[model samples]
Target chain A: MRLNLGLKTLSIFTALLLVAACETAPTETGDSSGGGATTQTSGSGSTTTVVTETKTTTVQPGSQEDLVLNVGDRVFFGFDKYDLSDEAQATLQRQAAWLKANPTVTLLIEGNCDERGTREYNLALGERRATAVKNYLVTLGVSADRLSTISYGKERPVALGHNEAAWAQNRRSVSVVN
Target chain B: MIGSVQKIRTLLAGLVLAIALASVARAELVIDITQGNIEPMPIAVTDFYADNEATAKIGKQMADVIRADLERSGLFVPIDPRAYLQQPKDLQVTPVFANWRKIAAQALSTGLVRALGDGQINVQFRLWDVFAEQYLTGIQFTTPPSNWRLTAHLIADAIYKRLTGEDGYFSTRVVYVSESGPADRRIKRLAIMDQDGENHQFLTSGNELVLTPRYSPTQQVLTYLSYFNNKPRVYLYNLDTGQQEILGEFPGMTFAPRFSPSGNQVVMSMAQDGNSEIYLMDLRTREMKRLTNHPGIDTAPSFSPDGTQITFESDRGGRQQIYIMDADGSNVRRISFGSGNYGTPVWSPRGDLIAFTKLTGGKFSIGVMRTDGSQERILTEGFHNEGPTWAPNGRVLMFFRQIPGKNDGRSDKVSLWSIDLTGYNEREVITPGDGSDPAWSPPYNLNR
Candidate 1:
């Protein structure tokens, strides 16, 4: 029974992740272009020259921007568990490929937790999550020297909901180019 | 206990108007605090007698502060002074027992403030049992004119100890993280204030994230986790000098710091390769010893009162549970067997119980249990409550409760709250902003 429930939750979580990624990707581009147009309109004669720099249009291969936009720089974890899920492993595999392409790029893996755990315990759990991602990248032939990790505990969350959906998003690890 | 005098700065004599032998028996008019529920004793706090207007204002202020201190303890209720038939002048000689009794006051507190030639103040106070019409306890304090608040706290402590037979926690301060901003980008600053939430001062500028500040035995130093320069490590903060330095260099992230009972050592967790283990560091020699070699997380270690045992939370048993080990990391034993996850186990100052945060069925609870994990009792439960810290007296526990915001959880309000050991008298300790991880300081013991 427990295994069935776990599988059901995982499926729902994967569906939610797809919806969230789709919703956020366009919003990010739209906000940047909207901000650019506002800034140009405030100037004397640059309103017509305002250009929307979309993520795909200005993508640089092997760059941090490209890693975030194309390869997916983040991997989510289950509550209180640092072991990577199947989907998380796939994301890390993509991230490892990107890092292997960008041989000169070093990364910082930031581990984060949901608000459900205690602060001190969450700090340790976050480190584990970050280490899990770093280990996967290392297994994929990434150099250990090129990776560093830190846990932000539950102090930072990307979602603002009190439900399971927000918590699933908050409990994640993000590989940032340093 | 009645004859005890706490003299500070100067040993000026504490005047005794009348030493009635029967007062000793009347002092037995005590409140049984071990029980969870009890009515607050009605006591009258009259303004202290002063000869001039300048001293009169200080006298009134001291009385007001004393009244607030006693009332906040949840043991006593300072009766309204307007119904007093006698003025401050009546306390100059003795409180007329008949007048105090008419207002239904079971106890009465009276005092006098005098300015000395050396620009200091001499404050003396007496607690009287109205039903017995006898003096219970009294003390005299000589301090600088600017320290009237501390003097008032001392007087309240004396009265509290006399009536309840337990050491008072009023003369202590609390160190906690003052939180503000939204959830994702919250800015937390190290803040300290009197136990009553007065005399608040922020120790950190909130530039770096700080958490879980624990006071040293001397109360002059603090060990906490800070993301200073973006490195999450344990750092030592000197309270007096406003100086901070990272603890000894470690291989990985060091966090969940707590000082030993003697304040000469610190126990914390250092994470390497994602595995955290408890380690002890001596301040004098900077020697480090790894205590736990578990692959699972073991952190938040707190010392037993005698420094002989350490209680912490670990997940080595496939889930988070409370565990106990000797001071030297020997004799490791798991104590908690309940179904829920247990974390942040803090030993009581009195050495009888360990307070912890328990999460079961998505509800968080602040609870306590015996050192052996027997007689588990939940004190308070809510949507999100964690990090239980004990008061200096061991009679109360302080922790933070996070409530969802009206619109969203991003703007949730996290506030510090305190509750007695009996699971009653839960009161919010109001701060200027959101507060968390409150650690109570040892009694100042100013006169010791």
Candidate 2:
């Protein structure tokens, strides 16, 4: 588990570099000064040169780290509500596309809830949340056979705070590649 | 594993003598506990008389245990021994009524412990009405010396039942979830202790998450939910043998399990895909019956004492509410029409009231209503309270209350508390650390 988190962090770093690469020139000069390269972006009749290290560590596609870093592995819900928001659906769309590309990878959708609800009711609510994600993915052409669900029901929490910020993070459904 | 003492062996020594003494009694003293508020009866307890030093020490400990038991019930206040005018040795014949009355004691309890030469001892106790100047009742227990604590509880139970006209809950055990660590990654283990929080033992290691443990009718078995090997499922445990097993074969998560009153069946919820439905499994035959076939979530099923009806919380009516149906999944009707969401509706053992947790206005309250869903009374309310379990007598309810965490929620704490059915005498049941989801066992059989 610790190793996975570290790798997730590393892939997130790699993703930031790719985003930076998009803002700069598409091509990098092979000549480097002190292990750095300069890229020029030309637009609006002006040219700007940006200096940075142009190095990237490629993460294996269709892997758990790839899902976390690129397509988003989880989506949040409102307090005591399981209906998917537009943002959650957008994330699920990317996840569905990713799953289509990696057909052999089975996904475990874990439904979770904030600690505000009772244990049993939250169990039901969490299941609904997970099912909402699964149903949406199915509409996006992901097979039902490749997707399974479980509700943590506030038992497993990602954020441990009493305020809304933590609760919003805790109430989510994460798609785990198994 | 400290509460491994052998079961008690009872020998009623003073039954004939106490009955003979009761024949000449007048103006019997009694406590009416059904009222909302009443003064606690003042009772005097003396150390049990013993000859040897070792036996005398046990006698004194027994006296202290009995006094604590009676005091915790909130029906009696055991007087200070320093104010007692009669010593242990002086109570061999009878308690001087004048000395006890001068101290304003309404009742007196005295006992004697004698070793019977085989690592066994005979503990005898008697309750006396001070103002009436008459003997009330007496009993004797023959058991190993290590069972002195149980002997004291038995004496307290006898005194309580004799005065209050209700069974005493002293000799019972409580199985609960002992929690520790932080809020996001809490460690919960199954733990059992005496009603007074003695003999604390953790039934399961905290390696996995466990919750909502319910005791069987036999008191030797429990059914709870566990996240074993990351497969959330219902599991059964045998107290005597320390054996655990999954309750059923399910493709998804199975939780909110409770044993039937007959101890031969279990009713629980199995969540597959996104729908949760209630089901009943016969323990003997392993036959599973689907009780509710709705798309809405239905869980937290508890059976009425008679086993003719089952009460559960469901969202079939658009939101979480308490509902009751026949034992065979017929005549389903919604019983809760309160202001907020209701869940965890536990049927009272007396078949009269149902206890539940209600969330209203962003707060949680423990309340009870009649079987017909009338006379709804909120016993206690706070920032967060859930899961109310009744004592066997149905006159008290124990629930867990969580103190909301400050800042990061790392300071979050949960503890077990009990309140009278009359909504009085709310006291915290002290545990080694934090506790939750307490289930009270039925009154133990002294002979067992």
Candidate 3:
């Protein structure tokens, strides 16, 4: 349908502009250990491990390598809950490690929801979710000095189909590394 | 025979005329009140039954807060206290239905209190349907005198939910950072309170600067941004067990974070070495996925109801605008194209529309539009309005507005407010202290 095509074209045009703008913003983000836990200071050890040395570990900043993140990095929440799970903690730890070395970095935590309730409630719900992550990192020995959190309340999304997989993806806390 | 035919013809003409009149009556202008004030279910709140000691001590401050809460819902109107006839207690035996009906009140509410055998005060109240001439709802709640305000708000929420099929947001809680002093020397701490602006409590002292605080979808966990060591990161607090933890240890800055629709994952924005993108982390497995890979500054990503798509803000189009993409970052697109730069696009749970902030011609407004970027309409306009959150019904949005009183800082006053999509009812949603960045919670359907 023309509507679908138009949507695609509009997004591509906007995405191109965003990518170009970000390219000049400066790549100063600390290397992420992974998802949930993003502490640059290891919970167990203080020795810093260079994430870039493992070429296979993280996507090189501005490199030609594919940046499409696999499912291995996304953190999920329980129903109506925003606490970071052990798995979530691990992911954030990885992200934290990456952030420590990259001092000029900033990020936006987007709270999202699956399609089941009202929009306003979801927005508030989304906000609570993003705040949970920001708070968790602040306690993990990461500086509250560098973080900002915002909620989309289920307005923006990444998947299109209407199914369980889509819903699973919809119920997430996304990290936008600047 | 000639006479008989003439008479029959006359009768037929009369019948035709009658039919014409009936149709005309049916076509007459008929307005539908079915759309009744979806704003907070307006109810008249007289003073709550309080100890003569309490009422005399605080004046009517408690009653004022209740009235404010019901009104702030954009749903209820606490009838002017001057309208009280028999008082909130006179309704126990029989509320003068005629008195409330005369005020055009669809529902009536009243409250009172007495010491319970358990030492805690037992507050009692009733909600009446003036039209139906019956008590719609009434109950007794036992709480410490300190919690009387919270109980009063719960009463308002009950009446609101009974009249409207939607859940009430009054009883829920909000946690946010309170900032004061100079920008760099700002003193910040975490504060929590009922969505109605009562029972405000500080979670942490404002010695260090706190940025943002968030709530857990399923539990009492609250996460937030703090600057204890001059570095910004996320921290969590448990309401029930009083436990605390840190989310992650990222290198540069890990700012924004949110729980997935199921409340199982955290989707947040991270900026490393200047590259901004959206990523997701599984709470159970700690797995990670990059949702956006544009060279543009992609931040503020929100999920669609189904989670397969996300909407976010980006500078890819020369200015900040809203965009959506596949969950896996396969198909990316832009959603805002109005005269202003758009930021903070949130999907409705109903999957029909998205709400956003429009910065146009130097003025800021909150508006909504279809997912495909058509049929956009601005709901509220002012000197500045940003950080819009929704009511459970999507019929209303809550945002903060700031207006400086004078050139001096004394004029810089910020207030929380709610407005309907039709733009008919615009009022302030009350918050303790100067309020900003209000996030509405899901209808609190949980049992007491």
Chain A TM-scores, candidates in order: 0.72, 0.70, 0.59
Expressed as tens digits, the lDDT of each residue in B69-140 for candidate 2 is 989888899999999988989887767899999999999988889988887887888888888877777777
**Residue-level lDDT tens digits of model 1 in B1-448:** 0112237543223445446543455446798899988999999998989878888999999999989999988999998888898998877666789999899999998888998899778887878889888887777776777888888888888888888999998888999999987665578999999999999999999988999999998658999999887789999999878999999887689999999999999999999999999999999999989999889999999999899999999999998999999999999999999989999999999999999999999999999999989999999999988899888889999999999863243457899999999999899999999999999998875634
Per-model CA lDDT versus the true structure: 0.83, 0.82, 0.57
Better of 1 and 3 by TM-score: 1
- How high is the lDDT of residue B8 in model 2? 36
RMSD of each: 7.3, 7.5, 19.9
In model 3, what lDDT does residue B413 have? 62
Please write out the lDDT profile of model 2 over residues A40-106, one tens digit for every residue. 2212112211112222244468887678657777888987788889988988999988988887999
Any idea how many clashes model 1 has? Answer: 0
B1-448 in candidate 3: lDDT tens per residue? 0001001123122433344345432221111212635444446766665566664232255567667766765556677878666665454455787887777776766666666566566566666666666555565665566665556556666666666655556656666555444211235567776665655777777654565455555656666655455345556677666565666776644555665567677776665533556778776787667787765556666677677888887777766788888877878888788776787777776667888877776567888899999999888876667767666556667777765443222334666777766665778756555666665555543342
The C-alpha TM-scores of every prediction are 0.91, 0.90, 0.59
Provide the lowest-lDDT 10-residue window in model 3 chain A.
Answer: A24-33
Error of 1 at B252 (Å): 0.8
C-alpha displacement of B36 in model 3, angstroms?
Answer: 9.9
Candidate 1's docking class is: acceptable
Which DockQ-derived CAPRI band holds candidate 2?
acceptable
